[model samples]
Target: MKYFIYAVITIVGIAVIAGFFIVGSPGLQRLRRLDETRISDLQSIQSEVIFYWQSKEKLPAKLEDLTDQVRGYKAPSDPETNLSYEYEIKGEKTFALCANFSLSLGPEGNNAAIPIPARGYSKPGFAEVNWNWEHTEGRSCFERTIDADYFPLIKDQKTP
Candidate 1:
């Protein structure tokens, strides 16, 4: 009888330990939430970047240039560190948005920031512009090139 009680107690303890590992600790969960916020901030900035390009027919030289008081456009920085996110123009229309992530988003693309890469969201006579936004743990960057057809130099200009 004594041995049976010990076995049952041991089993219960093991289960509790396993549950913590599966669900993760509270601190870890908090970090994940912060990463999600970072992703959201990046998405908002991306939209503004595209708009800036479309309106000006050129990409902004710096992220700071994205802000407009009338448009209420305010670029966001890192959530945890409260630092500016990394941005660079790779070419005429190509650019990269970078951030440091706490956890790895599986290759399955679960909860991807922008899963729709090259998505066709433009009006008629435009090519796809959106791109997939996925990342792994640690520092990562998402590179995208503006599609000229989708975003012509002239605002509201449709392809023939």
Candidate 2:
């Protein structure tokens, strides 16, 4: 009877440990999902900003400036917090995009582990460029500069 009791207690202890992880996993997964969404959202906004500079020959004064119906692009808000991503004009050809991230950039918890994919422009001789958008578990910002020599001609369109 004592042996049976010990076995039951051991099994119960193991079950509790397993249960802790099983219950904790969803929250971790949710955080990772939110981080991924933030990365993707920033990437999209980066692309649109580059396009806007190429077409307009000027940095957008605000995030709202990129939302023209003719461009068919809308700035994205945070997936989890529902807050608008932050944008700031740094200079004539420089700007910054900011977001809140829920997870560290990588398994090692180092910012350098985060990979910012190279974005390619449609223009000739303007090779793919990396924006170096890296983040940690809270708020992070990325700065970008448009090369003046590579500006593409702006397309004329009626404002909607």
Candidate 3:
């Protein structure tokens, strides 16, 4: 009876640990997917803005500028926190884009931040702009970095 009781206790402990990992995995995957999606969307917008600016010699200041020319056009925002995407234009050829992203791993207090290069959200007819995460700063899983080829002066845009 004693041996049986010990075995049962060990099994229960193992099960509990397994359960935590099982439940947490999906959440982490979702966050990663969300980050990737945001990056892709930003990249698409960036290309459109670059083309538009090259032709017009002026950058747009809002997402609406790309609506008529850009298909499936919808401004991307932070899904988890319901925050707006950020934009800032530098000079005539450079811009910045940012978003407040959420992570499932909670705040890792990671001193390092990941940069999303040549990626940003922009509406057609808008100027090149800079973006950065806001609201849940510590919880953000992604950061912004401009591609030197696209925006030679792209610099780190800090979010409030």
lDDT by residue (tens digit), candidate 1, 1-160:
9999999999999998898687667777777787778778888888788888988978899999998999888899998898999999999899899999887664753334323233336576555445665688878898878877666666577558
How displaced is residue 45 in candidate 2, in Å?
1.0
Give per-residue CA lDDT, model 2, range 9-71, as digits (tens).
999999988985665466776776787788888889887887888787787888888897976
Question: Considering TM-score, which of the candidate structures 1 and 3 is the better prediction for this target?
Answer: 1
Worst 10 residues of 1 by lDDT: 111-120
Model 2 RMSD in angstroms: 5.9
Maximum-lDDT candidate = 1
Better of 1 and 3 by lDDT: 1
Give the range where candidate 3 is weakest over 10 consecutive residues by summed lDDT. Answer: 103-112
The list of candidate 1 runs beyond 4 A from truth reads 1-19, 108-130, 158-160
| Model 2's TM-score against the true structure | 0.70
Model 2, global lDDT: 0.76
Question: Considering only N, C-alpha and C atoms within 3 Å, which residue pairs clash in candidate 2?
Answer: none
> Which is superior by lDDT, 2 or 3?
2
Better of 1 and 2 by lDDT: 1
